[model samples]
Each structure stands twice: as C-alpha cells, then as structure tokens.
Target chain A: MPSSCDEKIPRIEHHQNNSDVSITICGYWSLNSRERLRLLRRWESLVLQWKDVLRFEIKCDESLVWDSSLVVFLRNANRDLSVNGGQVVFLDLPAGLNKLLNLADEGQKRNKEQKQDPPSDGFLSMEALLKPLDFLGALVISFLNLVRGRSVMRWRDFFASARNCSASALPIVTLISFLTGVTMAFVGSVQLEKFNATIYVADLVSLAMVREMGALMVAIIMAGRTGAAFAAELGNMNLNEEIDSLETFGICSVSFLVLPRTLALFVMTPLLTIYADIVGILGGLLVGTLVMGFSALHYLEQTQSALTDMWEVYSGVSKSLFFGLIIGFVGCYKGVFSGRDSASLGKSVTSAVVISVTLIIIADAFFETAFSLLELR
Target chain B: MNVSGRDDIVIRVESLDLAYGNHLVLKNISFEVRRGDCLVVMGGSGCGKSTLLKSMVGLLAPLRGKIIIDRDELWLNGDKKRKETLKKLGVLFQNGALWSSMTVFENVAMPLEIFTDLGVKEVENLVDYKLALVGLAGAGNFYPSELSGGMRKRAGLARAMAMDPEILFLDEPSAGLDPITSKRLDDLINELKESLGISFVVVTHELASIFDIADDSIFLDSESKEILAHGNPKDLLKENTLTKVRSFLERKTVNNS
Candidate 1:
C-alpha cells in the first residue's frame, strides 16, 4: 500500500449535495488515493449544496477537473469534463494515445519548469500561516492547566528551573542592573551636589532596588530565559504529538507536564529577585565609592537611615512570586499550544518569550500601582 | 450474527452520525463487534472509516447516535461519562502515537498506573510480559524516537495491552510497511486476539491484512455517508452490488479518471 503522502498529486476534487455545490482545486501532490478520496469527501461536507451556482476546480496531474461547471477552454478540445450533479470533472486525455502521451510530456516539462524556480514573489511558510489568535488560545489553555494543581506547592522543580532560569541569566542581569545603579548614582550625585545632598544617593539606590527594580529585572530575565525554554520544549512536544500521545494514554497533560514547570517557576522567582537586589545595590555602592567620592561606610549608613519600613524588601519578594507565576503560566501555555511542526515550535518559542516579558512588565506596573495606593512610600 | 445470548458484543454502535462543523462525515452508521472477535472497519479514504473507529473508542463524539461498550452507554451525554467509557478501550493509532519522551516501559506502564491500582512491581512485571508478548522483550528502556516504525507499532500495541481492556481499537495498523512486515503484524494481531480474547476494531484499507485477520468487516460509502455493507469479507466481495467494492476486491486499481 502506498503511503498517503506518496499518492498525492495536484488535482481538483468536487462534491455536490442538493442545491449547494463546491469544487476545490488543490495540489495534493504526494498524497495517496485514500487521502485524495478523503479530501474529496471532506470538501463535499464543507460545500453542503447551499447554492446551485457553486462550482469548484481540482487540479490533477496534467489537467484540471471542474465539477458541475461548464468549461470553455481558451484553445483545444482536449479539456476537462464536469461530472453530473456538480460532483467532479475528469480532464480527459485527447482521443489519440500518442497525442495524449505527447501532451502529458509537455505538461510534465511545464511542471518541472515551475518547480525549479517557483514563483517566489510571496509565499508564507507553513509556520507563518498559523493564526496568532489560534496560537494564543492554545497557549491560554496550556498556561491555565500549569498553574492549577497540588504540585504548585512543590519547591523542587521550581528551584531546579530557577537555577536554570536565574543562574544562566545572572551575567546579563548583573551587567544591566549594575549599569543602571551606576548611572543612577552618577546622575543623582551630579544633580544634588550643588545643595550638598550627595548622601541621598544611598536612599535612591535602596528605594529602587527594594521597591521596584529588583523583582522587575529578575522577571524580565526569566521571561527571556526560562519562559522561552518552556515554549520551545512544549512546541517541540506539540509538533511531535507528545501531548496527543498523552491524551490517548489517558494521562492528564496539565498535571503530568505543565504542573512541574509551573511549580518550579513559582518558587524560584523570589530567590532570583533577591540575587538581583544584592547585585544592584552593590553596583550603586561601587559607583558611590569610586566615582562619586563617597566612602563605602557613609553610603551604607545613609541607606539604613533613609529606610523606615520593612515592606520595601518584603514587597519586592511578594512581587517576584506573582511575576514568577505569570512567567510560568505564559511559558507553559505557549509551549502546550504551539503548532505541530518545527517551524511552529520556533514561532511558539518566540511568541512565548515576547508575551511573557510583556506580561511581566504589565504585572510589575500593576503591583507598583497597588503598592502606591497603600501609601507604602 | 446472533443478536442474543453470548456475554459478548463488547461494542454496539447504532445509528451513528458525525460531522465536523458544517460537514456531515458519517450518516446513520451502525455496527457491532463481538467480544474476542477481530473486526476490520475498512473503507476508502475520507469515508468516515477512521472516524467511526474513533467513535467506538469514544475519541470523537458523534452528532447523533448511541455506542454501548460492555453495557456502558455513550452518546449525547456529558464528557465525564464519555471519558470513563474511554478508559475501558485500548487504542493503537495510525502513527503508533507513542510518547517520544518516555521509555517503552513507561509508555506501557502508563495505563496500568492511571486505570489500575497495581503497584510498581506488579506493573513492571506486567509491562515486561506485554512487551514480550509483542516480541519486544528487551526494548523497554528505549525511547519512542529511537525505535523504527515497526518497532513503534509493536510498542504501541504493548502499551495498548497494558490495561488489559476488553476492546482494542487500531487505526491503519498495516498502513506503512512492506508486504512481509505487514504480514508479520497481521500474524501477531491474530495471535493476540486468540490468546487474550479481546475484541478488536481496526481501521484500514490494506487489502491483504483485511483478508488475513478480520473476522467481520464494515464498508462505509463516502458518497452516501452510510453503511454500505457488513459481514465476512469473502461473502461481501462475492455479493457486492457496488462497482467500487467489486473493483476494490478485484484489485483492478482505479485511476484518476
């Protein structure tokens, strides 16, 4: 038996029932007879004879088939015939066997010509053909299942994933946080020196790191690192039909695959935020000591004196947990919903990272707003 | 075709109709598989043949109809009952549909873990026994990605046998293989059927396997969306009124014309 792919050749399949008729001209090249027949049957169901005027074309081999529609060839009587009841049209070969063979050869030559340099003006690969909304919908379903379970309480997978997420992300996060802190201290010192308020630079660094920057920076890093990984893994699984296999085996896809990853992210985010805060504050200290002419001891004293509440560190940690959950959910969801091909998996990974980072920022803003409303400052 | 008294008849599908969106794929389809009988649901492509097998295993919900499996009814009901019904069925998909991530042991052991309360040792012993039954005694540690197509199918069969279900559903079992390999698979299927006494509902258009293993068969007509015929393959071919069936059995091989 030929494989379904082997039997496919470009052709027009037609099916008509009652008033509505449909004709679909498609390249089923490489699909077997069974597949072609199936396509015809599927098209028949789609075009439920709503209008008597319905007509479609199915391209097959060297000629085309038109169903239930009259054909007027531009030249030659060697044309396709439309089937009765708008069912199908078989492109009949010319009467003479020799002429038919010659015509088929010509058609083959033309097909080969078309293939060697396909009209590449515009063609979307199968990956780009998928709708964003469909991908998003798949992602949402995947993400929801990730966050809903008893495994949410486990800190093992969280820490394991966090080590991968945070440890791998540390160099970049450290560099950016350090630069931000240095830039802020340098700018703050220059502006405040005229009034002899350079000491307030300590207050600036502490407030930013503890209240907003620490959790936010850590989440951005995770969105790029762990979130993207989740998408790629899930996308690959989706393409390979691992998720489908799970369903067939009576395994709950959410509980088995998504929960562990989600739980890992949920626990690891806070620790990452803490690491980010320490690095960021040290960046401010280095700038204050070497660049701004403030001693390290003086910087520490001012930072302590400026802080009045414990909520500053606590709040950052709290925000990290929320952002972590969001990242986990979005990452897992994108992966779960990704299209079932390598290209789709790549697209899924890209979209997962983009969506996760965007959400993290949006969530950070919301936290900031809520914290401010409480008058924590 | 006795309608009564056998403690058999594991699956009875009656008046089944199924559709996808605006298209009706199956219309008023009906069939039954006796316990321990091997049934091949054969048809041309897109004739709702695979879909009918899926409906039997409760994989796809029908538009209107009833499917009774081991006395449990499925149709027009909520998803919960339908899922419970599915647990009793073992499916071997067309592509072998094994999880690439897990080893063969894990794949076979999954059903045991989910549906049965058998402990790990018992499950492991059972998994080994099933794999050996399919002639895959030492391949349990290998991932699906590592196995060849025939091996994957055998592994899938091993996994399907894990739960020891009453009904086994296979879609296109001999679809992509050489004649000899396909024959081996058919032989294995026959052996399993005899030893386990489990009912089988297979979907395939493969001619040789159809004749070799199927105790009964059903033909679906794509044009009419109805059950065209059902009975022993030999009798159907001898008495078929449809030119399509005649051509199919004779292997005259229809062209694009």
Candidate 2:
C-alpha cells in the first residue's frame, strides 16, 4: 500500500512509568489507518503485553475524521484488552460514532428479545418428527370442516389442477409407456426366439405392463410433474401473503388452497394410470404383431390367456389410489411449509418430487410383499 | 381541481383524462397541488381516487393531456428524463407492500443503497433515523410478516421517506388499522408534514384521517366522474352547498353518539 511507514497516521505507543497506563493514538486516522500493517502488528503485541493493564485512557488527535471502521477497531481492541470482566467505557469521541455503537447495541438487544432460532433439521429432533404429524392433523381438521360445510374450498382449483395433471400430462406418459413396452417386447423376443417360443413375448409384455409397470410409471410421472407444480404454486402464494389474507378472512388456507390441489391429484392419478395401462398394452401388441410377424388377433388371444382374470389389473389400479394420496399429501406438505424465499421455494419443489417418488417406490414394494403374503398372486 | 397558477405549485395536471379500456374514469381533470401541501384525494368507494393518484405518479399514462411534476412532464419527457423526474416521488401502496423477504432495515435502506453511494455507516444511520421517525426504532430486524398491521404501515412509511422525495403518495394508509392506530398514523403524517415540509398526496376515504391531516383536498364523484369539490375540507364541510359534498363530509356512523 502506502509507499512507506513514515506516514505515522496510526502509531500505537505503549506508555510506561505512569500513574495510569494509557494507550495513545495520534495523527489522522481512518480506513487508511488500516493500511499500516506494521502498526497493526505493534498494536496486537502491545495488547498482548498490556492484558493485565485493564484500566487505560484513550487519547485522540484534534484533527481526525473517522467512521465505523474506527469504532470497529476500538471495539475489537476493547474486546482483546478487557477479557476478564473489565469495562471498556467509551467516553466522548464524537456524538455520531457513539450513537452508531449504541444503535448496534440496541440491535443486539432486540435480537435477544426475539429468541426465534431456527430449529435443527436433524432427523431425531422432536420438532422435526412432530411437524408432519401437526400438518396432517390440521389438514384432517380442515377436510372435516369442508365436509361439514363450515369452510371455503376452491373447487375451481380442483378442476383446474385435475385438468392440468391428467390431460396435459398424457403426451409424456404415453411416450414413456410406449417405449417401455417396446423395449420389454423386443428383449423378451430375443430370449424366446432361441427356444422357438417367440409367441410368449406377448404374454411377457402384457403381464409386466398391467401388474408392475403401469402404476409405477404413472406415479413417478405425476410426482415429478403435478407434485412439483403443486409445491411451486403454493410456495409462491405463501411468499406473496395470499395465504395470509385468506387466514385473516377467517378461512383456513389448508381448506381453501391445499385441499383443492391435493384432491385434484387424488382424483386424477388413477385415471391417468388406467389410460397409461391401455396405451402400454397397445405398444406391446404393435411390437408383437409387426416385429414378430404374428397376427394381431393371435397376440390379443395370448394376452387374454396370460391374464385370465381382472385380479392383476385390479391390484395395480388399487396401488395407484394410495400412490395418488402419497403424491398429493407430500406435495402440499412441502409447499405449505416452504421457507420464505425464492431459493427455498425451488428446494421445496425439488424435495416434493424427490420425497414423493421415494415414498411411491417404497409403498409399491410393500404392496408387492403384502400381495405375496396373502397369496393373491 | 385547478384554481391558481402560482409558481409554488409543484404538481399540475392539465386537462388530464384517465381511462381503463373503454370506460373513462376521469375526464378533463385539471389540478394543482402546491408545494408543502397535504392534498387528500377523497371520495366514495370506486370513485377513481386511486386512478387519479396513479396517473399523477407516472404509473398510468394519461389517456390525454399532460401531468407536470416540478416542471417535468411525466408522459411527454423521454425515458431518461422521466426517470429523473420520477425520483422526486415516493409512493405507498394500499397495503404496506413491503418486500416479504427483507428485514425492515433492508427494506428501508433499499432506496438509499440503490440510488445513492452513501457508506454503510450513513445508510445505517439514515435507516435507523427514518425508522425512529415512524416510531419503529427497535423494529429494524423484523420481517414484514412478523410485524403487526400498524407496524407494517409505519415500516412502509419509513421506506417511503428513504430517498427524501419531494412528494409522498400514500394510498389508503389507514386501510387496515384499528381506530387508535389509524389516528396515531394520522398524527405521524401531520408531524412529518410540519417537520420535513414535503408535499403529500394521500388517496383515502377515511373521514378521521382527512380532518386530521389534509391542508387541502379534492372530492371525486363517481357519477359525474370529476372532482366536484376542492379547498380546505373543514371549510368545504361548513360552506359548500353541494349535497354530494355535504352528505359525504357530515355522514355519521351509527356506533358514534
């Protein structure tokens, strides 16, 4: 920085052989005073040397203009010098700097008065465990209130979200299911053609699509699509205080906003799953007939024989009902409790989809095990 | 609404007409708000007081005619010149409209930080002083949602005064407060008018606030779609012969004696 240290803008001197030990500062000081690295080192060592000399006097220059940087330096110096319950009483050093320091102290006092430290996000924390339970309890009460005609629920939101998730989502869901069926059929034919059992490809693709793939695919699609949408919409509404104005009008935001979104997902998820199942079976039929040179009627007959009853399709459709509920509940939960910022809202949407997908897979596995245990398969 | 053509007039609306789509709200409206005047724009609900206020503040362009704020035409001036002219105004919305994410200190300091190159110490001092002026000295750390309704208004007022604008436009400052809180806010407005000597154009229908703070006022009529009365509101209440003006000013609530 400066060309030389001869600019004694800041010179911390250790006074000795005096009635009172005094640390004296002289010359014009400012933020430029910080550029004196040599003086800073000398000041630190002097502080270390005079740790016991807690009572000292502060001397100032007559022609010095300073800012908060000086106040910050002195406060830090005070903290270092008076480590053992000694008072660093600041006498007069211009009224504005004193007022700034006093305002800083008042800010600290106000923060102390509002003792709202954010709760820890550890999994074992009691509050974290209880939060979901509390949200569910409120949601249940709000639902009851709605059923009893005591609360306002936006039916338009329900219809709008239902239309969005079901109709608008068909294109991607169809493409994914069609590709999955084609892949399954193509792979099954490779193994079966070697043993001259190529016709069984029809059985393989139909059974997988109806029993396992259909509901799972639809649930994952909805989790990423509709569930993430729910989280973002509610999170924005929460940030803008639209939800708060609802509360001030004595209307429950859960009933007014969340209930409609959740209900839309619940009603639409199963319908989309059924449509996906049919489209997937059509995909398999196309591959079995066109690629394998089998007649469409024969492939249909083989699929019918593979599924002798409605039991397999019923099982997948029933699983989709709970899948719908999981997606709806998780999405709204993430949204309704989202933090108050754009970044946090983005995280809420991501976590809504992630958590819903994970839960859907876990629930599907449990359903598979339950069906096996009951010998329903 | 226009009467005198004195040089002290800070804002002059000349033959201004405002409209939304096909419906014209105010036609051939002319007004002059003199310097250091607390001019309350009062009317019944949906009389377009807010629309008139908005037109003057450069948010809405006039369908026709001109709005001059301190000799700078709002619509006729080019973008760069208009922006400089707009810095002379500060506005408070119907709600506090404080940014939800920022603390009260950040909210009040935002204008200073953006428009000026003052140091952190000065910005902090100015923000603290503005908050103190609004009686929210210790509320710098709280968010808008954490504040009560009255405190939210005061914080918004503090932020409005951040740049020391020549005119402050307040839309329904007493819209959501209790009677006592609204009265205290009226008193604070009066004190600011006396202390800072800044012009205020307040859009409200609150009778208590109008009587407490307005030095001059305009009453916009919905049916006629014009400013029917202008002058000191207290004087208009006693002497104005129009039933429309008398009925509005002398109207009493059943809960009061």
TM-score of each predicted structure versus truth: 0.73, 0.53
Error of 1 at B65 (Å): 1.5
The local lDDT score (0 to 100) that residue A346 gets in candidate 2 is 99
Taking the tens digit of each residue's C-alpha lDDT, what string does model 2 give over A139-222?
788789878976566566678878998999999999998988898999999999999999999889888988889999999999
Candidate 1's docking class is incorrect
In order, the Cα lDDT scores of the candidates are 0.73, 0.81
Q: Could you give candidate 1's per-residue lDDT for residues A1-377 as a string of tens digits?
A: 12222333434445555544444444442323455455556545544443243343332333332221112221111222232334333343323433544555466554422223422423365544454345445445645744564221234444566577767777888888777787778888888898998889888888888778888888887888888888887777777556765665556666567666766777778987888787887888998899887899999888887667778888999999988878877788888877666877888788888888888888888888987898864
lDDT of 2: 0.81
Once fitted onto the true fold, the runs of candidate 1 whose alpha carbons sit more than 4 angstroms away are A1-196, A305-308, A341-343, B1-6, B75-77, B255-257
DockQ for each model: 0.19, 0.02
After superposing candidate 2, which stretches have Cα over 4 Å from the reference?
A1-11, A18-22, A26-38, A52-55, A62-67, A84-154, A186-196, A239-241, A247-255, A282-301, A337-351, B1-257
Error of 2 at B186 (Å): 7.1
Per DockQ, the best of the predicted structures is 1
